[model samples]
Target: MKTNRHSLMAKGIMVLLSLLILIFIITFAWFTPPEERNDAHGVSMKTKAGSDFEYAIGFKTSQTFGEYLVTDFTNSEDSEWDIEDLHVPGKMKDDQITPVSYNLLYDYQPIDITGDGYTLIRPAMDYGNWKINTGSFDYSIAEANTQYISFDLILRSKAATTLSLGPNSYAIGASEVEGTTAKPDGSKLTGADVERKSDYGNFSRDAIVGAVRVAFLGFDDTLTAESYSTGTQDDKLNHTPSLLWVPRPDLYLNNNGNDLSTSGWSLNTGVTSGTTFNLQSQAMNDAAYSTYRHQYYNVFEMTNPNDTVEVATDNSDYVHVSAKDTEGNEYHLNDSVELISLDKPMTVQENNEDVTYYYGKVRVRIWVEGTDSESRRALSKGKFKFSFDLTTNG
Candidate 1:
């Protein structure tokens, strides 16, 4: 009789355990949205970040000839950056700045002719250019809220080296990288939507990536004072300091389907008419290399503007495709691109160092090109990565 009772008690315990497991499964399934599910249906975006925009500078794990670093203006010995894991990259606190893990900052709002999206603004540079006066505290390194996102990097080489900078293609979740399907007029996609297996969305744009420009500003001769220059062949690149443009080709808008998504003027050359709204075609590759400076566009309007843009003089509801840089330099954003520098010097800092290897600082400025035809309000949701490759040009 005791044995039978013991068996009955064991059975009861098993039943309780099973019930608890079932409850957990039901609760999880009921509360979790498809987008947040752990399954591979919608969540694995092949990126370390989940924000509207994700970025990284990666090199193959096999290449270890020289030392490469992503660091900030911190005085700590461990100032080296961890790019693969999403870490707080110069998060701006009213009182202090520290590296912590957090949600990434989204795109700037109300994009206009006078907005931050219009040009390559460099507020940070090596030798402590990014440091600012806190008033209450000593000068501290800070990042702009909307103006731009800059990264500090150091690359080491024995001598002058020419690096190969290439871009990666993008793809939606479990979808082919055919291309984006959303039209420039902020309309829904037609051939790449995951739900319909056709119609790709605005989450990624090809021309958007092409319009991005990265320049190796030059090498640094100082490490504690303010300095900036667009030096000639004497300064294309070399040891201790440089500037680069980290491209976010997969950048998307936060509120894509809202009324605001359909309200902006499509980039220049979009299919539009006087005060009448129409959807733009799939894409317009307005990212052409400027043999001669494309005069900054001047938007023309016929009273109420629609989802179209054109040069001034003609009576149409469109905008001219030109903007002023941070320094009041007028040039179309599409025309303001510079390729990465070649054979820059490298910097080295060791108490008893050898002349074989050298190190240099590189400041990467990442932002969306505001004048690209794909910069419409509707195409907002995408992920892309960067490939930083360097090889001798011998």
Candidate 2:
């Protein structure tokens, strides 16, 4: 009887052990397998050209645009992009951009003044579209999305060459010599003043020179010598002269392709000059240049503030990426990116061969923190109204 009792006890102990092992196996099976994340993303692209003047005189302005692969990202506290290798080698396909139309818009004041100091000013607006042609895209062995491959093209002036001063009217100082007539003092001068005094040389040499000066120097024609301020004409209205950037061929090499290829530009950190990152205000308080302090505005952060830096404003804004968490599915901000899409102004230089070119790159310099995969998908698109303006430094 004692032997029988021992066998039953042994069986009970073995059964308990088996039950515990089975329980462990069942628990492991119930847990979900680690998520299989594939680092794949679908990217879409669009392009636009921005400028105050869509065309020059009667000449239609044009620019070419394309995207390169970026792959090298500095995994530091602050993200940095290394542009040593501009193209991505492993990616079979590259991002392609369709030919974008560059629409030009401008506001200008054309002045006509009478001898009596009465000025008539007419403000005009213009529009034009740029023609884009795709070029060769080379690849580099840099990390994906970190390597940059630049695509560039030439921008030709294709407008019908319309006259700024139409045929109906002659330029203020360029008119042909008409007959001279009455003078400002109502006195008849000797050189054919009997018929028309509007001749190019009809007025005193000073007056003719003054008219030309006024036209180009932006002087107020209505002010007479007595009415004008005493300070050097520049002192009273000391505004830095604005410019229209015209590209020169000499500054850059023009190959047989008639195109210029550059490593292009990536986002440069800090306020280092010549960086293309857009400007943002932390809404902090400061004293100097306060008009632009708190407000958010577009800035080119270029080396030369005197040189004209043009931007396209028809469609520009921050693109926010967001997604929802699986648990609470709480949507959160993933990334903040800004791209400045504008018609690249041709760089015009003196003592250089003038070649018209249109080329620009969109750089992302600022990335707001807290960005993740899910949030990026949620806020796939965001847009703000944009406008292009002119700035000059003396």
Candidate 3:
């Protein structure tokens, strides 16, 4: 009877494993699998003239888009993916992005007029330059939601290795030419101007550069690399899929671009060159900047804040991770994660270049963590040129 019971338990575990694998396969099938990324030097890919645009993204109608891959993400159209691998390891866009994006988010004035060497990052709101009294954070700025950048893509691994991602060779700067024809005296607002606009769609990459987060939907954060991939289908389905990220690169002041920098930022900001006024009070209001204290709204605690480092929005109260838990609560694993799928290896041939790789559907997100310390101080109008490096230890 004991042997029979043991046999029963073994069978149960096997069935469970089988179910998990089935679900994993279905999940990938539900979402398109990773395929070849191609280029045509400006020649139509359909024509095969070998003229692939350096890089392309978004709708086919988009001027900035290159007809690299014929898959239309937003429209859910059939991808023109062939049953071949381009035999290339991986390559990035070679040319600079033409005409980088621009915006009227900020017309920054030097804080030295009031006395200071730092900038303030306000809440996701619009407040007209409300020059408030020293140490007052509760001024006229309206409260609102913050803007962040995000995208999703499939990572085809070549081996069953542990994976980690990092921003490689990425830099963003603002433009020199400031002020728009419309708001020339130059229009700027505080909490009253643009407090966290609820519309997530309207935002600029002119955000804190370092506060980036990655989510591998195929795995669970709480579980080990082995179990997480088999954990649940809910984690994959709960969050919305983002369009493949394709940046429109360009030049700017530091880089001038159209991203909003919260208004009345100077109000709470307290980066002064002295020890005169209330240090404790400024700290309370959260604009504390002096020899004695340093705290900024944008510093989301992705890292510990001490003498030398100022991690963006280090506090979770400010950082926002959109994924939710099984109980539907916001899941806050707010950092990039290791992506481990199956060891099942496959090979493909494209343009007669055969390649071997594993499949891992990955969701990648990047944004200026508004809660980061450097966010407010970051250039408002700029271009962010980004690339990702996926490495592994099998």
Candidate 4:
């Protein structure tokens, strides 16, 4: 009887252990994560799968002055890719100013793959040799990732003076090298093309220079050669006197002591009938006068009337002027003067007075430093325009 009981207990323990093992197997089969699941066969199995492959690129629509000029490209595919080559095609309007020089800033320094930075990537003639070969460095775009390429558009001071006030467009192209793919229409990837425009909407003729008028204060004809030399004479002398004097006849205007005035004096219109002058129409407030008074007078003298002259308070009097956009952002005049000067042009709408104002009007001032005839002839007068095209590839 004892032997029979022992056998029965041992059999029951084996049955219970089998039932636990079965429950564990069932639970694991139902609750296992998808990545860890086995095949239908009771044996463990593994498999690899992926989706349809693709590739693409895109750019930002607009950019403002003083802001970083960023050009970005995106890759939309599972495969890694690289930019084989890039080309930027640009052109200017037939009558617009030609771009002489440009300096581009890169996020990463360009490597000397071929020992010549110019041959690889540099500003050349209008759309001639502006192509860049970027294969040396690891300029890679990971699966479904995006990369940004930026440039700080810099122009020679002389170049910015000639930039036209309108839209300038460039054709930019980028070619894929590593993994050339096809489009939805089944065409292979030759290259991608995009259009970019540097719009100078705020720097228009209507905005910079408005209606203009001129008035010449006549010469004081009362002085003789003898009286001119004598310090006792208080007579107003016209033009530069034969001899040097402290209070000599120079171009002077009534600015309520602002010293802002137009060009030379004349009986009829100031200087000439068609001659235009840019004068500070209003008086400088105490704050502006205290801060920028010296700059105001200095720029007023150096700047030519009617013609677009860049003026800056920081640089030398002869240095090219910087400009502000409609948003009041400052930029080099050579790059583009799409905005007004910080000195501010006067508007008739605000002042409501005639008196042949100069602030907002398209005009320039004239002043003879000495008796030099050539210096007087250096005054420039006319309307100016500039246009150009630019292209980039990466």
Candidate 5:
């Protein structure tokens, strides 16, 4: 009877061991495999399965100006001119001067006056046998004859070679010359007594004479004097002037034997199994993209391509990357990032057989941070290329 009790006890122990094993197997099979992670230089990539197959994606960038064209203006005349004949004063026609057009929506003052002053003045009287003392004469008497002309320029959007001066934009000087010439009685003829005679007539004697100077103002805060002969005028105003409105960066994704559509850089992948994608960017020209402090953010969204059903819509799904300067220091998304790299590798898994296909979009946003006054005025404008490598492992 004792031998029979021992056998029954052994059978019960065996049954308990079998139930434990079955439970363990069922629990392991119910849950999916844990994701694998890899990191390099502070950048991390996660995937459900190891990447075995890889393919490179090539991206080419082409820059195109907005509806308006950025142009440079040049003055055909010299900086100074000699007005020999008063009848025909040295005239700088509107055609000779280039005008700026307003295509952007920002308020722009093309020309700024920096300084105004007379450099030299010489007065003479055209009276016969009327000897008068030069130093004794009142110079203020000729002030009425001296008139300054100014142009009221306007900015308009039209296809033309040159700019046109607005209506009633020009101010004409005094037509009649007014000044005192020596009289036979050794007296002075003043003011209205002067006639509208010849250029140097007795009525116009002692008329103000001097050289008037004008120049293009510097756009920068220094307010430097820019001249035409030295080519500083064109350098300051025409070449690569600060843009008032800069457009956003253009991004594109090219896959195997597929190109981007006119609609944008949106990509639609037909892969059912999980996939991995690699990202890289191309540097743009200095003229096109100028930024003192640059920053970037990578946004993503997952949805059903056919049904427009949303899948991953939270901020957790998005990843942030940064650009490095000449030094090896890393910049945050909120800081300037001149040279950027992939923040992290992305991994997508199949939730259901019916939802085999994953439709998603990757968007990149770039901006400039203003740390100082100079950097605040700095703008970012350009077209850059980004390459991708998509690998699929089922």
Candidate 6:
């Protein structure tokens, strides 16, 4: 009787195990179903010279049942397409369940530009003998099974000024090279082009790697103190120190060529129209009052009872006068004056009011120097409006 009880107990245990396994299988089928997958697509485009190009991607899914989750597309580190798997669950004959995966191949329209989505991908340069390439960021998407889904992409070039580096002409593959150098065998050298693909969006794969080297660096005029010579002066004065001087006139004569003893002018001949004078200086650190001479013409303007004076000098707006050594090499003077007028003055029988005038900016060009006077010495083009301060010689 005990043996009979053992056999019956063993049969009951087997039945229980089979029931459990059947239940597990049914539960899994109800919760998670297989999804239809999409086929991979390829990318190719033809662009115009100096122009931007675009392409698009399109996808479709099978009819799905229950709730469907359509996620963003993701990209591989090197490819340019979005891919995802579909899943479905529940009864298929009733509305509770639906067909999962469908056809693998579909139409993918070219975006107006490059890359994925409606975003633009710009070329780095013009379309010439060179090539252009750029990379996009990685992205991803998730979708539910047993549902029909679609992906649409619009590509175009970025706005102007967006393409300023790297290749700007041809589309290159992994085997192609970029850069301005050549291989030892005299062939051309190039750089790489890689972008990530995902549903989340896009990002740059790496920094741009190559560009041609330009020859001339920008010139800083303020930092340059230079001068060229006439046959009278040396070819040009570089950062020379001996040219520093502050110029001022020491003598003045009247229209008759008679020396005027006073430092200013007192006019009677129609308000002495020539009493006003202009002072100008050269750019140089070592300029002195002794190194230069002055020549000027004085004129007067009369308005009824008041006389206005104006002075004219040799220094014009465009002329730059510099100093030179015995050899004629032009040098920068800390200061040099183009004498307009001197201490001598014209006798005026009437209107003697003094008025000061001002003109033009003071520009200087200097060099790096260590000597006391030579240090920071600049040769400059200087102009001044005469301050006609007339203290009535009571």
Which regions of candidate 5 are displaced past 4 Å?
1-218, 222-232, 237-246, 249-251, 256-277, 280-394
Where is the poorest 10-residue window by lDDT in model 3?
15-24
lDDT of each: 0.25, 0.16, 0.24, 0.16, 0.16, 0.17
Q: What does the lDDT read for residue 377 in candidate 6?
A: 8
lDDT of candidate model 4 versus the reference: 0.16
Clashes of 3: 77
| lDDT score, candidate 6 | 0.17
Candidate 5 lDDT, 46-108, residue by residue in tens: 222222211111111111121212222111121111111111112234775643222111211
* Local accuracy of candidate 2 as per-residue lDDT tens digits, 1-394: 0001100000001000010000000001112211221111111111122211121111011211222222321112222111221223243333543322221111111111111001111111111101100111111121111111111111112121111111111111111122321112112211333322222223211112111100101223233322121111221211211111100000110111211221221111111112221222111112221110011111222233221211112111221112222343222221222111223334434278664433212111111011000011111111101001111111
Instruction: Put down candidate 3 lDDT per residue, 1-394, tens digits, no spaces.
Output: 0001100000001000010000000012123322322221111111112311111121111222322122221212232222111111122244643423311111111110100011223332222322222222332221111122212233444455444432221222111112211110101111233322212122222322222222233323343322222222223421322211111111111111112432312222112224323211111222332222222343322243332222222222222222222342212122333444434345656589985655444433333322222232222322222223333445
TM-score of 3: 0.31
- RMSD after Cα superposition, model 1: 20.7
TM-score for each model: 0.35, 0.14, 0.31, 0.14, 0.14, 0.13
lDDT of 5: 0.16
Best-to-worst order by lDDT is 1, 3, 6, 4, 2, 5
Q: Which residue runs does candidate 1 get wrong by more than 4 Å?
A: 1-147, 166-216, 219-356
Can you write out model 1's per-residue Cα lDDT over 1-394, one digit (the tens) per residue?
A: 0001100000001000010000000011111211321211101112112211111221111111222222222222222223322343343455656543321122112111211222332211112221111111121222222233333333334444433332211112211122323122212222243322211232332223323333343344443112221111122234321223322222222222232223322222212212222222221112221211111122211344332332122111111222223342212222222222323442334477633333333444444333332333233232222223222222
Cα RMSDs, all models: 20.7, 36.6, 21.4, 38.1, 42.7, 42.9
lDDT by residue (tens digit), candidate 6, 9-106: 00001000010000000001011111211122222122223332222222333432222222221121222222332222231444655534322112
- Which residue pairs in model 5 clash with each other? 294-336, 294-337, 323-339
Q: How accurate is candidate 3 locally (lDDT)?
A: 0.24
Worst window of 10 by summed lDDT in candidate 5: 18-27
Model 4 Cα lDDT, one tens digit per residue, 1-394 = 0011110000001000010000000111112212321212111111112311111211111212222221111112222211111111232235655521112211112111110101111111112111111111211211110111221111111011221212121100111111222111101111122011001111111110001111111124443322221112121322321111111011111123222222221111112112322333221122221111112112223424322212223222222212222332212122311211111112223257532111100111111111111011111111111111211111
